[model samples]
Target: MRIFDPHIHMTSRTTDDYAAMAAHGVRALVEPAFWLGQPRTSVGSFVDYFDSLVGWEPFRASQFGIRHHCTIALNPKEANDPRCREVLDILPRYLAKDGVVAVGEVGYDSMTPEEDDVFAAQLELAERFELPVLVHTPHRDKAKGTTRTLEVVRESGLDPSMVVVDHLNELTVGEVADSGCWRGFSIYPDTKMDPDRMVAILTEYGTERVLVNSAADWGKSDPLRTYATGQAMLAAGFSADDVDQVLWRNPVAFYGQSGRLELEGADADEGATFEGNSILRGARAS
Candidate 1:
């Protein structure tokens, strides 16, 4: 089945992962800006990271025939840092970029007042830019975080259909469903919802606005979980169209709100150069 992973962190991944993802039928993906394991000290660090998200990463993914798009934001964890806060000013420039499909990974991390302020401000940015948003609910105290998230989303006055609250499980999906925002599940090998559990949610929810992703990053995450989820859905008697809706159509509908998804021409060009640097090393293979 064809797939579009709506949320993943490709900055921390290698080219091998890209090859594997393409081989497994992942044709497109959205990489939202997020906290790196190492704390970034200044806005400049974020600048470099954001540049790569819009530049190098897409080139790398294209080398594997995967159309890569990204969301730009000062992620929740870093919003608390005084130095990192300046990055928010620079965000408008990136948000105006071509491959930036949304403003995202923007929501509660610690749920600090700092987080609250930043999250709201970014929502305003999303509204002003007329782009969709990818909201990240806290890994801890998720139910509470998600509730607070929907409240702020409501307060922001952005259309519910324009937002996607991600990293959900059975406990939190219902509230997001009722709120009219899209539901996003990150199928992980451990910790978050697995493939089987995701299938059950689809069974109950019937796959209207649901988006399933690998959400893979630098951690112990699996990049092929989206493919795995599709396989599980088939095993559980889901039709091909059902898998297509969850894996492909759902994400396109959500991120397509940006009017910036470039799905065609994803074929790999090994000779491609981003800033005069190709993915190839020293010598050409003869």
Candidate 2:
């Protein structure tokens, strides 16, 4: 039952989250750069965020026996701010860091021109670095946004194989699949697809080129929604292997291209601590 959560925001989660995910068989995770719960006011903020993704975060996950990797990008929601361009300029540096698996969480929110600029720029960064791109389709008006996201990928001249269009639902899953890129679903508690609906999508698409994530972040989303989706698949009579492939194999195959994932031996301790620091420091051992 080894699993990989291909999209999570560990920077917004707790150390207990890492332990819980590992206890539930999440052997690895990939956290994409995202808009902070509060807006970032400076480029230094983005730098610290990127450092946490590759540095303290991975060290923390190891304590829970979960391998950690990440996607680095400017989130679409933040792209509109004129200040955001400064952060975008620095993405190439972060994308090249160890444990950065892709350029992502990048795509449209309001379909604004700024979103396009950031999205397109990151796509070029992905290409420039020969990395994969993880896209965050708009939460609202997903059907329109998903198509537009595909179009942007086409216009950027990036390989479709190096793109993953995430946060999809039934409305856009077909188009996303037909576009010859990986399709990702975020099984959230309220805003995104529920477990029952996620199971139906897998049944409809047969899981060949699809992926599922929690998209867990500062929102009221469950960090283990992907695991819950697997339970739903079991209740629906899907074979264990079928469930495993969609939830784990596809994401690993996708992110492993970045050359960052690592495994923890069974004997690994996964529990260590640092002095004078809390989860706020994000550097606690294991």
Best by lDDT: 1
Candidate 2 C-alpha lDDT tens digits along 9-71 = 988899878866765667688989898879888888888988989999989988876778888
Give per-residue lDDT, candidate 1, residue 10: 95
Worst 10 residues of 1 by lDDT: 277-286
Model 2 clash pairs are: 63-270, 63-286, 272-285
lDDT of 1 by residue, 89-176 (tens): 9999999999999999899998999999999999999998999999999999999999999999999999999999999999999999
Query: Candidate 2, overall lDDT?
Result: 0.81
What shift in Å separates residue 176 of candidate 1 from its native position after superposition? 0.5
Worst 10 residues of 2 by lDDT: 267-276
Per-model TM values vs. the true structure = 0.92, 0.90
Cα TM-score of candidate 2: 0.90
